[model samples]
Target: MTDRLPLFPLNLVLYPGLVLPLNVFEERYRRLVRDLLALPEGERRFGVVALRSGREVGELAGDPVDAVFPVGCVAEVATIRPHADGRFDVVATGATRFRLLAVDDSGPYLVGEVEAMAEPKGDDAEVMTLAVSRAFAEYQRKLTGAQGRGPVELPELPDDAVVLSYLVAAAMVLDLSDKQSLLVAEDGTVRLRAELSLLRRENALLEHIRALPAVELLRQGTAPN
Candidate 1:
């Protein structure tokens, strides 16, 4: 079913189950937050779409619809603390995925017509989940060591494949486009497979250059270690 939702264009991607904290200082977004707050507890939500190309603050150039990715996650408000100066500190969790169908810019903030998306566990979800868990653990260790953080205590990976997929997608320090790809993946198995490949690639690069960022590693064309 399709529904209308308030839209917030951000520079980052938010996967289902991820927790996002926002400082609402922008006038338009403040209005969005106020509107959401007026709704009942369970009904407060806004769509968070990753900006394709544009600043998160200020005015978006050209068309607002063209500035963001069509795929987005609904942020369900958990807590809202309003400040004396009209600013708000809000904590929300990613609840559901949605596909933006159309944008109405007539409002103070962008409002979108969206259709909710379903997450299916595709073929070989169990097998791929195991593989991804192992790969991600190693990737986490290497990433921590490379950042001069020494050893890391790997968190226990979630057993549910869908949860695992979103956890890795949200936790990994990947580029915006890469993270968005994971968000828009067809199913749990597909997301896990993509993450496994990404982990291997990142792990290889981290082994070669123990301290450089992934962008630098790519630029330098460093071979796998």
Candidate 2:
């Protein structure tokens, strides 16, 4: 079934179960925030589509966004802070996945007729979830080290396999195409497999870099080498 919801097109992708902090400075988006907060708690849900190309609203001048993968996760406002400058600092938590059907030009923000995506299912889902979680833990460690930070504290994620898939999807640094593929994946198993593959590739790259002798490599092109 299709339903109408307020759309917020961004330059980033949001995955279900993830928390995204947004700074609402533009007048149009400030209006969007106002309208969303006015609604009842249960009805305060919106879609977050990544802007493929375009400047102003209703202008389709930029490169066309990949229509085949035009779905984004629906998010609910978890916290809202009104600023003195008529802007807002809002934290939204991904709630459900929604597929955009059509864009409506009724409000300051874009509105879309969307259908919620279904959760994944399978038999080996539990094992897949565990594996994905492990991968994320390792990735988090590497990320923290790379950022010159201490070890990261892992969050208490759900035990269910499907939930794990969403968590991994949210954490991985997947490109647009991979992210879109995850959004349209038929089940958690498929998404988990994809994320695992991505993690493995990243791990391989990191390992390759770590194995290289930094000093010697740097000395190769130096004078009198």
Candidate 3:
């Protein structure tokens, strides 16, 4: 059976085992925050879909929205602060993965009926967590050199395999599609491998860009010589 859940279409994708902080300022999303807060704790789950196309969430205006992938992660609000302007600052933690069924038009915000996807069990979880951590460390090293500084220090991750997986994935500079794929992955091993692949690709691209002659890059409108 499909269960209805509030939807938030974001330019970026969210992954399971990650915590995302969002500024809820738009009218519809603000309303979405309010509605979730008003619900009982168990029913406070919401779906996040990476918007593939279209500029605005509700104003598709006959333009095609890149079809939302069926798989997404459900998030539960972890922390919420109401702003003076009636907006919200919310930190949401991924809870479970879900597959979208249908989107309802009769709501202030988009609503979708989704089927929850079960997580995989076993020993590979630890292995995957380690892989993600290793890949992330390498990615960070490259990114720091490219940007000329390291990211701010983050909290230490838990020793538990599951929590570690989420923590590492959250810290990577993954784009929306990559994050979404991680969210829907059946197990930590799968997610970790995917993240590592993305990190490698990004590093390779950055190296390639860095190899170009400064003057040539400038001519291509990329950088100043």
Candidate 4:
């Protein structure tokens, strides 16, 4: 399961089973996209790791990944829209996660030596997935109300713990570090439990916002987000 991949370190974390729409406006990334498109469909992919600090390699950071976490998700390009100005708009889906063993800088983009991570599963994962899904349902309802809308019924969730956890985490409004921590978590149960806690906390905040006066809530800062 170990292999080398073209690395693109972003400020945001991408979880498996989620879609990430990227604007490859930079020349380096454009090149990366071009190279990927040149490959066969099965091999049109790259590694997207979150940047823990500083900028990504595209910005020519003093070090390509001085503050980056070693775990990342693999992104398979589903669609590519090329622009006349040499920019690219690509839609990719997260396939699986990997742990970085090391990095190489000999290519135009960062090359990561990585091993596919193991996915944990069991009764604990199933229970945690249910708990997190319940909390997320409440959270979504609260968020809808905060946005001046009626309640929204949460949709049926995935039965698999790994898929459910990643879906809930990706749809929630969380900071970079928190999401990154979830991404770096090796165990599915751990990720699900953490997400349950986060969903509860965020739902509480949303409930508080729902209790505020419309004008007051609007002025409260970021509009209940």
**Clash count, one per candidate:** 0, 0, 0, 0
* Backbone clash pairs in model 3 (N, Cα, C under 3 Å; residues 3+ apart or in different chains), count: 0
* lDDT of the structure predicted as candidate 2: 0.69
Kindly list the per-residue Cα lDDT of model 1 for residues 1-225, writing each as its tens digit.
999999988888888887788888888888998999889999999999988854554557678888899999998999988999998888888899999999999989999999999999899999999999999888878877787776756779988889999998877778888999999998999999999999999889889876855321101121110
* Candidate number achieving the greatest TM-score relative to the actual structure: 1
- The lDDT for every candidate, in the order shown, is 0.84, 0.69, 0.66, 0.77
Clashing pairs in 1: none
Quote each prediction's TM-score. Answer: 0.92, 0.79, 0.73, 0.87
**lDDT string, candidate 2, 1-225, tens digits:** 988887777655677777778877877778888998898877777788765533333343333244223788888888888989887888888788888887776556667889888886666787888887787777666655555565656677677777777766656665666767776777888888888888888766665453322221001121100
Per-residue lDDT of model 4, residues 1-225, tens digit only: 689898888877778878778878767677889999899988899998887765544554556556577889999989988989988888888899999888887777788899998877644987887788788778777777787876555578887888888887777777788888888776778888888889878877886774533322101121000
lDDT of 3 by residue, 43-112 (tens): 6778887766545555544422245667777888788789999878788877877888778857677788
Q: Give the 10-residue window scoring lowest on summed lDDT in candidate 1.
A: 216-225
**Which regions of candidate 3 fall more than 4 Å away from where they truly are?**
61-67, 121-129, 150-165, 204-225
lDDT of 4 at 102: 82
Error of 3 at 171 (Å): 2.7
